[model samples]
Target: MTWTLKLVNRQPMKEKLGLLVQHALKSGVAAGHLRPTEIPLSIALETPRIAAHGDYSTNVAMTMAATQKRAPREVARIIIDHIDDSGHLLSKTEVAGPGFINFFITQEKWYEVLKTIHDEYEAYGACQIGLGKRVQIEFVSANPTGPLHVGHGRCAAVGDTLAAILEAAGYQVEKEYYVNDSGRQIHTLGRSVFLRCRQILGDAIEFPADFYQGDYIEDLARLLVDREGAHLPDMDEEEAVGICARFAAEEILSGIRKDLEAFGVSFDRWFSEQALYDSEAVRSVIQDLKSRDIIYEHEGALWFRTQDFGDEKDRVVVRANGQTTYFASDIAYHKDKFERKFDRIIDIWGADHHGYIPRVSASIQAMGYDEKQCRIILVQLVNLLRGGSPVAMSTRAGEFVTLRQVVDEVGRDAARFLFLLRHYDSPLDFDLELAKKESNENPVYYVQYVHARISNIIKKAEERGYKHMCWHDDFTDLIKLPEEIQLIKLMARYPEVVAQSALLMEPHRIPFYLKELAAAFHAYYHDRNKHMVVSDDAGLSAARLFLVSAIRIIISTGLTLMGVSAPETM
Candidate 1:
């Protein structure tokens, strides 16, 4: 399973067709049919939005018309005249509208996808487009303050699924969780816990309103009291708070790890902010930036000239009090990431951090690395709903619905699926009642049912003593119904969909494709006349069975990419 072999086995239809269009342009140029001095470096082929337009439409002719000194349609006609269809790839080629070249692939050529799917099975849509580039994706790096809420859950799902997609597209990926363990928040958490411990010890201390009010803090305090009750009565307040902070941070982080594991998210590394300071990396980065003149003193503060590299203004790396800002640590963290030699660094942050992109990009650029190498994905907030009404959540007050609660209530499959129902940048409204439903209204159930239905069909066929038939040369001819053709076409587009999704760094496309595929299968299944997988006609039955088996494989693959389950039953 060399990368080259994988690519050869799954070269997408779009790529193959694009090559033909490229050849056509070259032929026209060489034969002097067009007046361009040289052909363009690449030809762009896109699927026509309207099915009636054609399977694929390219506007290369329009792009070349000026240089060719001819009307767009005339250049298109000349390109069509020179196209070599020796492979029988296109059944019809039309020059339509101003200059677009529309290609209708032959039915037989489309059927070849069925054999490819049969041969490839689980690896049908996998591609080597990434060529094993090393990519580090840092995500769900939620501060170790409290239990993860639904918003964190959504970020987890998006990052995990995006990693899966990049892997399928042949990129070596590492998932990371950045633990912000050293900050004011951790001290606040410790103080909160220490106050709770005093209350547990019957002290009449007033709890501050600004401290963490989550019930989890009280729970941590109780645990701490049970572990060190005898010494707490005599311990110094600052010393006890430090101990409590360390204890609470470690406990909360442990719970965070467990919840992510239960949610099917795992990290290759748990990077600590304190470690950067301990190793002097943060201070070292500031000095390096100062030597490069990227950092300067301004009004008694150390400022980084971020505005010089596209930021709205210079940013303070260290305040007048001489404490380093979070931005300083971030610069050091990203500098370390670049030094690690990953081909790409991806950070998934909450949408509220959208304004922070430019400064981070500036930091990367200031560090002498291309800012493009660092990609940031912003995940929007998730609004949890019960029966369409909003579920209130206050993180500091600790009334929020934890990711654990959602998973426990609706199961991991539904939770992950619903979290990824929309793009990461768009706010998601996750309805608890809708997600738990067992009917088609539940998108996960709808997609998973396609796999289950096909599984049952195959099982029933086997029980009826129908011997399993491998894909045959004539199977395509037998599968000529409009519905069957449509399914094969959709399946043929799977490889392209995956490659495009990876290229665009979008994982939502996978679910969108799966839903479309499931709908097509459901429509075909409900029409009883064409729905039988095992019938008197052995050839047709075998072809239909193979068609559905391919469908099952795709459904399973898509769900697996989303970190969802494709259950055999319900």
Candidate 2:
């Protein structure tokens, strides 16, 4: 049998089943077997947990039953009867519990996915769900006063992976890091370094309790002394502190850049908070709000009417002392984002910033944009552990584990994969020992091992003189084992997984799907007698080789989305 490769990407198996269900509903209406009401614009199809249920299940019948004023199973029976399987898409259909229509798809239909993976290769799981809309994801915008911590690492992984998933779903994506390089924090950093510099020059000084106490402050002071030859303490104190603040901020920001680069995250822009003030954007926004009466002076401070736009209460944008609040700069920053014309604005902030979302979203609305356009993802903190015991960390004391240190301890792949194993909103307990493990207990190793195992199998097959076949070759009946069919079904769900993960704006779904796929493949591989890939039967070996190669492609693609590598060797 000759196979024809279609130029267009094939619809996912779930989508195909949805279309078939829609066709059956229309056919039942046309035949007068069911009452004509409204059909759902989009039907929902789900996979059954138990293997015996069916390949795909849908409750469209039950949804229609309420409108049809008929028993659910009766409607299900009518719909299933009218289902047009002329394309040989389904082997059988059954009305299961409570009117769910379970569809058992044909083996030939399932086999088509292997060929689809072959035809599309790396692009197999990609879809055009995003439709080229512009999206800006701002994450890990940690204050430049200190190095990034474990929590910042989680934010980086989630934001970067979400951006990659959106890109795969066809969104025009840009990643941004907002730099908080101004305000009191920077001044505090300057004072900390200046005090350290004075102590370095043999002047005994008592370090203030409020000052930053990390050894990094001393490092910065020593660097300043090396550059200026211990004359900083002799200069005017205020002028010297000003110089120290600028120097320390730049040095810390540079370290943040190196750490993120090592963690494999790059941003399209680094927006400056000070630039907002310097360019008068902050003043301009406040003036605009005043002109529109959105800002009113109550206690000698300018307050934005956030309550008008769904906030709990009005907030002060400019304090009574005439200095703009951090909220003022936030308003200006988000207004700048809207002015950039991004269709969607995503902010990945720590869960502690949960209360800040309402006011910022209100600012977006006050700027004459839809508040819904700005999406805020709050990531919970990471509790660092060493062999299940809590790892001590104190940010003010500068004794916390930095992102650089974590990446150094556990490789980037392990750090990233473990960071994404759960949803962003859920707190993660990151164990150093577990991440360093190379065995099956470690998730990254488990997933990466599947790719390596498949590579070794393909190499062994090539050495045994098995030529890889083209997509046009017919291999339907050759891969008939239960495990092989299950693998094909799992592989077929990848495109849907990518699309859904993008739709929900959750990057954890990709890792979850990959872990499931890896477990299934491992089970099949370990059962060597029944599931050998390179058997003496040339036709069977060739077909199994084709299936395993497709699996490898999916694993590699999933890992790439997570910013992890798919090594050919463990």
Candidate 3:
């Protein structure tokens, strides 16, 4: 069947109206009246956070007035006159509050949205803005020197969730981790492990203050002794450190993958810094830069004139010590990512690495690519709280708790949910005891309880013979409840939620949206006994049953994206 025919059977009214507004606004611009380079069509349909204003409101007229040379009210009136929303979804459009167009969709349209919830459940909350293009998302590329801490945990969750959101919106997305094995830090890691190996061999080696002090280092020492021998025959510290670093990296990376797996974070690939060097991509990229005249030598060190491309300062591509800088390897790595045919590449880095953003973009643009094609999502630090006191996490003292330790103490569900509780850019304060609490006071438990309650509702429906009743339009009277309409309206907005999360690179929005949806289910459940599903009417019960099932599916879909559980029974 043709797409137009297919859409006629299924597309939601909100999507159609959004398209009309976009087309109409651009048509207004083409008619020699307005211009829209500064603002987009989306700002014109943003709903006020305070629900009393309207269903959705926008300030398109205000945005276009500078080009129209007319008042925003006049622009809004002209646009409204051109709009043909025969459906009551556009019940009224008025210019209000400083050139804003406020639109109130009708109650009947909101009620009709229930049919959309069920009709599109399999492909329910999806968008096609990506146009089937492949995107690569690299995140939590921490050094494999030790276990990941709570701070790294945030990036892992954010990156993985963003990938899920993009995939849901029909993008072919790949999740990757950049392994920093070929760096000076790995040499330092080797030295730290070898010290532990010496201690295991009964040698009185003085531990350096900067050495890794985690118990895992001692475990690596034991592994080396068990696999090799008790006595070292005149081996230099450098050779021993090399062995230790190699062994430590393998063990630590294995443990890192296991920890992320337990947290439901999986990657499609683990790209290596060493691999770039081995493939000679690094040398090829450096040669390409030299051909472009962006590379130069000053005081025996090679530099890239990144300042010319918008970086704050020139960056060293190679230090005077004959070793290339990490920044250079990064440029090569990003070039490889782009050359692999991904339309977009997203890098999720820790907030501490915020300074690296400008140089990376400058390098990308200097290599003849648009700076906008590269995106870096910087996640703020995660403050760990246990019993209300801040848990001191010092890597120098080896006092940092591993991601696995956090998961063991609390759980995968609690850790995953809490990591995604805030905006991706906002600093997350993760409380351990609060996460483990089984009471309704725990936010994770509170959200999961709603899912469980709805599961119970489904069982009650079956016990009341709803299992045999065919779900059709005739039994939609129960969905006519005010609360039922509210729930449907929330579900109807899921596609937009997914789209926003992907475009803004904020996957935490998914968890927040899930919480709001679960809140609706909880409020409805709290009123279940009093609200009376029976209502002395069969149609009411059927309609309520349909709405409850719809909510359960949406909640499950959202929680799954975050790797959190949707328990059938609390």
Candidate 4:
């Protein structure tokens, strides 16, 4: 299976620097200072923490000293001396710490980053690492038995942002929601709604101990009575339960769809678990496993030899009573995904499913597919807090806050922003009070304020009789202040940050990067001695406007990726 490559349209500054460093290393070998055969397979360049150290730092010499049979400092000197600076990309190269070669990019060259952002606009951070490979991300596959709670909201935010990130990195991405409408959960939903319906028909029936107790069940009951009241009363209990189940499942799924859509999540597919059973895909998978000697009858129940493929134990695919396990449907679902020819399949499951990972991986291997073709992302629980008190939630008893309620309370922007503010695998403490605040302490407001502040500056510039023009004007040398240089450097790092986030499958890094960029812009704006955006010198004013425009572009691009908005005004 060959995938066409869609390389980045704009060459990143880091890649260009890496190429320069590689060229210098080869030059050193050609000049006889280092052995050509001893060249390392890969070279790494990193940004130094202290601004005084340099813009970029590499420790290749230190790692290669033993291979080249020379002192680390001598190797560093050889590489630095042979480095070509004719392009004037580097201001100077110096040896720092034992053998670290630090390259300081020319201050004027950093301004070119602004031009790249202006040219690419919304595509400033987009790259092409995935290169048109088909990848399907299945996330927020909550069963249609209830409303999506705050935890599911986090999963939705993470999954949606990850899809956007992968698309930006040039993957042919499809987002999907797996509907678990075939299982025991659906039966429970139906039974719960049916009991409520009997009550609506004036029956004094007591609710079961294990029945769903959500108010939404009452809504589904009312809906079912409205649609099938006359027919339901005439039917037997078993037949009515089936009708109630189907109606309740569809209604709950509709509500789930609306909640996700309101929270800015959309899926390319909504796969039905019952469809697998209806089409006999589940039976076929079991038969295939049996034929491959991967399945055996143990105590009258059919079992898959998952223990042989790294699972802790063999798992039952079907019980003796002829009921299929959820595991069976999951195996068929994954098999169906691979049959669709996606090069990569990602399943975002809740953290409680952590133990289920090895078995699923085993299932893929058992089905004659590479385990590496599938990746499982586990999203941890969200601890909803109000002030300092923990919010109580029990989904079975329906005492939890719905995701829609959170979005309505704090607005969609804040809800989504806070959800991704922390790593998905780590437990997130969502403070209801803070998320709704307009102060700088709120992360969403802090980052968004930078964007709004930049907009105000642009508006102020236009009011001063200087209309903002296209960013093709040269202002590279005009941006000389240290704060201006810092902001440009941060903006230049946006593409690399996005690429790293996509490669690592960590969208949380984006919010952290945005915070840093926002802080840099705030510092630059508050520098007392100069009016950075509006000035007497038209050249400097244009230059400052260009800087603000680049900042706005990067912030908006990142916010869009997180499904959060970048407002023009506060």
TM-score of each: 0.95, 0.96, 0.91, 0.96
C-alpha lDDT of residue 412 in model 2: 98
lDDT of 3 by residue, 1-570 (tens): 677755643555567667667766766666645554554646446757876667777777887888767898998877776666755467777778778777777776665566656767746787788889999999999889988998888888888888888998889999999998887878888888787877777789788877777888898888887887765324876888888888899889988999899878999999999999999998889888988889888899989989998888899998899889899899999888889988898988999999998899888898888778788888999889988999988887778878888999999888988898889788888888898999866778877787888788778777777664336666554456667767777887887888888878788788788888878777877775755554446677776767777887788888888888899987
- Per residue, candidate 2 scores C-alpha lDDT tens digits across 347-371 of 9999999999889988888888988
RMSD of each: 2.2, 2.1, 3.1, 3.1
Model 1 lDDT per residue over 1-570, tens place? 698755553567787788888888888878877675778776888878898889889999898888888899999999899889887889999999989999999988777788778778788788898999999999999999899989899999999999999999999999999999987789999999989998988989898889999899999999999998657757888998899999999999999999999999999999999999999999999998999889998889999999999999999999998988889899989999999999998999999899999899999998899888889999998888999999988875778899999999999999999888898878999999999999878988899999899888888888877676587878867888877888888998998888888988888999999999999999999887757778888888888888888999899988999999888876
User: lDDT for model 1, on a 0 to 1 scale?
Assistant: 0.89
Task: List the candidates ranked by lDDT, beginning with the highest.
Answer: 2, 1, 4, 3
TM-score of model 3 relative to the true fold? Answer: 0.91
Model 1 regions more than 4 Å off:
1-9, 36-38
User: Any runs in candidate 2 off by more than 4 Å, and if so which?
Assistant: 1-9, 30-36, 472-474
Top candidate by lDDT: 2
Worst 10 residues of 3 by lDDT: 35-44
The local distance difference test score of each candidate is: 0.89, 0.92, 0.80, 0.88
lDDT of 1 at 387: 96
